[model samples]
Target: MNCTPIVRQHPDGQSINYYGVTLFDEQSSKSLKGIFTSWRNLFESAPNTFEITGNFVDWDNEQDGEYERININRDEVVNQLGKIISMSEHLAKGNCYLYHLGK
Candidate 1:
């Protein structure tokens, strides 16, 4: 579950998961959604924030343009996604938060 550059241990004892490093546009949005459809509820349920310590966004309130999509090799993402999920489970406990920065 240890991935180089993806999960880096900070000096402050914080584990940084670089799952959102990929940037995607409108074109890949559909494809990305297709891959993540199964985890839609999990993602939509998690709390999200625009900044590190900003107000949380109401997932139900936002209609569109809420999150960014990823455009990458389909197979590559599939593999990385699995790794990230495992890492999350191993690293996180009760409530985990998702951070989103729109384009």
Candidate 2:
């Protein structure tokens, strides 16, 4: 898979460049779908499918993305959830975003 460029466009029209890329596979995508909800909720903007702008990340609560997966095995989901929580924490600090690329 090709790496998707992650950039943040500020309200002033200036874009901030990020050094690394984030990737998600088919399994990970399916896994995340349970947490992100519908397209209207997660993909609010057209032509920018994998982008999560400041509009969604502007919140102060890091646990805002939490969801209960009662039937799912915790061992399989723990690592991913931990990483997501870490990312949420980073976004909570401001001047950043959560983005990824997939097939």
Candidate 3:
């Protein structure tokens, strides 16, 4: 799986940069969703700055066998959250979709 940041401009004139995580299977998708939901408040806050402390799976790495997992430190989460919040501010008013590209 590969995690990439993508910036997209919509027809309506709104632009957003998505923190995309590619899932190879259903399990991975579910796991990712759970993580998002778990940190819903932090992501939704749109803080100019913030910090996170926990062990998170790093999607940038390759896994072995049936399951793959990489540990994401606190710094990485903070960085990713910052990007999401910043991009979200660019969204048109009343549009609540958190941009994410999955494949």
Clashing pairs in 3: 58-70
lDDT by residue for model 1 (1-103), tens? 2122221223332223344343333333334344444454344444442223333355657653244443334444455666545544433342333332322
Give lDDT: candidate 1, residue 85.
52
Candidate 1 has an lDDT of 0.39
Candidate 2 lDDT by residue in tens digits, 1-103 = 2222232332322222344334333323333434433322333333432322233332458656544333433333454555664565455455664564321
Cα lDDT tens digits for candidate 3, 1-103:
2222223443322222234332123223333344444565554554554544544445656452233344445555666755544444433232343435632
Which one wins by lDDT: 1 or 2?
2
TM-score: the better of candidates 2 and 3: 3
Task: Give the alpha-carbon lDDT of every model.
Answer: 0.39, 0.39, 0.41
Best by TM-score: 3
> How does residue 78 of candidate 3 score in lDDT?
64
Off by over 4 Å in 3: 1-66, 93-100
Clashing pairs in 2: none
Off by over 4 Å in 1: 1-71, 93-103
Q: Give the per-residue Cα lDDT of candidate 3 at 55.
A: 47
TM-score list, all predictions? 0.24, 0.28, 0.31
Q: After superposition, how far is residue 35 of candidate 1 from its true place, in Å?
A: 11
